[model samples]
Target: MNLENTLAFAKRQDEADELRDFRNQFLFPKHEDQNFIYLCGNSLGLQPKVTKEVMSHQLDNWANYAVEGWFDGNEPWMFYHKELKKLIAPIVGALPVEVCPMNTLTVNLHLLMVSFYQPKGKRFKIIMEGGAFPSDQYAIESQVKFHGYEPDQAIIEVFPRKGEDVLRTEDIIIKIKENKDEIALVLFGGINYYTGQWYDMEAITKAGHEIGAIVGWDLAHAAGNVPVKLHDWGVDFACWCSYKYQNSGPGGISGIFVHEKHFSNQDLNRFAGWWGYQENKRFKMEKGFIPESGADGWQVSCTQVMPMALYHASLQIFNQVGSFEKLRNKSIALTNYLEFTINEVNKSLGTNQYTIITPQDPASRGAQLSIIASQNGKQIFDGLMENHILGDWREPNVIRLSPVPLYNSFEDVFLTGQALLAITKKILKSS
Candidate 1:
């Protein structure tokens, strides 16, 4: 598609968009009296209009049923997550039984490590991307330490070649093979949170399995933003937070996926809780832990009803618009428009005032474009906020803007570009 950088073009695109009406379903933050052009879905999504009503329904159930809410009520607390599982499976490309909603992102990562990160004598290292989200870095660091292994010794971090901003697939695979004997687990984020590079998950999984290592992914940014076939890719386990692209509230519920192949492996370790017991036998309250079949067996506690309620609100939108095909198409177009608009900014200013660090290929990224302002970077980011354009700013100097297809319009991108141009012009004049 030949991209244009004008408000008329953007409004035309939005007007012709089949998914345009979906934007009306969300509640956007206002600046003065106008809505802010929210380009921060990679960090946090806007609240769905339906979130309040659905959450209130759960609150009403609590008031009406009290302690009996577990068995009674429309969405029984005992099995509330069951419907959620069905909603989540397609989004992450798994069977309903292979996925379960529970815990926070890092908590689920730790729980999964308990079962998957069993390091034997010779094979005792975990390999992952170097600049993963801080949660992953902290979680992996602590997990290795808990297992009585030094963090530096037990972890192999694959880094981008110096001068490059993203990891090449070849470099990652070569590193995994180099440590084939010592690497017990291969862990990676589905998409690098900062650079917005979507790794070749299927290729990485195959390489890990070929080296006789268990593989996993933290799909914090990729779960709903990009396509993933976790089960088909033979990824041993994976987890994601619903608050970002999925549009659940802040610190919303997290989800997990365990392939069906791992279901019958009774030797697998887990920190069990009452909710994870086999359904029929749970009420009997017996001694030994006979785990519930599939990923549900990994649950360490009962559902967090309110968090799940928030998550369910978002998943319902994903479900209503089956097969993320349309959303993906729109996402690609929106991101491309954003990139084109940014380039237009640089061209107009004739100084390359903003540099995009994210991968150029649509296949290698999702909705986000991480840009570094040539000068006064932080000030430029602050300017964007003051002008009612909400994007994420990383330390040092990276402004991450994500044009989410669900609620974002082409006009939002156009307006953001307009604001960015003005901000850069003002900053250049000052300095």
Candidate 2:
């Protein structure tokens, strides 16, 4: 479909969208008494309307029952996260045992790495994508240092060939093969935060396994924005935070996946804690740590019920919408329409400054498009914000706009494009 010259077409698509009504389910932040055009789901999603209700219920339970709320209530705090697995499983395409809602994203990453990144002798280096999120980079560097190995020696980063902004699947496979001997683990983001590039998780897993390296993924940008198949992909492990595309509010609890293959491995050593103990005998105050089976074995502490409640409420909406298949279908159409509109506006302005750094191929990205305004990047970004279009600016020049499927509409995309066109003209004239 030709996206340019297509406002009518966009309206038609929105009218027919099965998920269209979901836009009203979110709480939009306002500016100048207008609902802001929120296109920042890649950074932080708009809060779901149900968040307050869910959070309040948990709060009231806490207020009335105190310590008894842990086991006495209808939705007891002790097992609050249990309801989340089925809702979350389909989003990541993993079995219930393979995933759990707990901790923050980077924390879970460190824990998963501790178990999977068992670097020994020469086969201990980790292969990751270059320019990953700063938090992820720090986690990997610290993990390497903690292992008594220098970061440079234990971490191997694969970058795109010069001039290209995104990595190719073929290059990643080649890198996996080249470092087969030294690489102990292959961990990278499912969708890159900066470039908005979605990596081939299944292919990456296959390549890593071929070299006898365990494969893990940081899916912070991918989990709700795209489809994943951690179980079918044979990924060794994965972790994700729910705050972004999942719309679980800031610092919402994260999740982890441990492949079923690891469940029976008694020899796998982990830093043990009381919460990881078998549920039936957990309160026995046993002298030895007999860990629970499956992903629960990785639990390091008591579950955070408040964050889990918020996450659970958001996840329930995903369940109601069915699968990522349905949500991702809308994502492609919405983002493509936005790209088309932006390009059309760019042509009218006679400037090529706003180039989309995200790949054009739908398979290579999610809803987010990293637009690099070559001239006056920050100025244009500030202009967009002042006009109440809430896309975020990253460092030097890129403004990341994500048309989130669940709570964003076609009109939102159209309005933002128009706002951007006006903003660009004003910025250029003033500059």
Instruction: Tell me the number of clashing residue pairs for each predicted model.
Output: 0, 0
lDDT of 2 by residue, 302-382 (tens): 989989888887887898897678898999989998898889888979878679989999999999999988789898888
Candidate 1's C-alpha runs over 4 A off are none
Best by TM-score: 1
lDDT of 2: 0.89
**Considering summed lDDT, which 10 consecutive residues are worst modelled in model 1?**
318-327
Which stretches of model 2 miss by more than 4 angstroms? 4-7
Clashing pairs in 1: none
RMSD (Å) per prediction: 0.8, 1.1
Assess the local accuracy of residue 8 in candidate 1 as a C-alpha lDDT between 0 and 100. Answer: 92
Per-residue lDDT for 112-192 in model 1, tens only?
A: 999999999989999999989999999999999999999989999999999999999999999999999999999999999
Per-prediction TM-score, please?
Answer: 0.99, 0.98
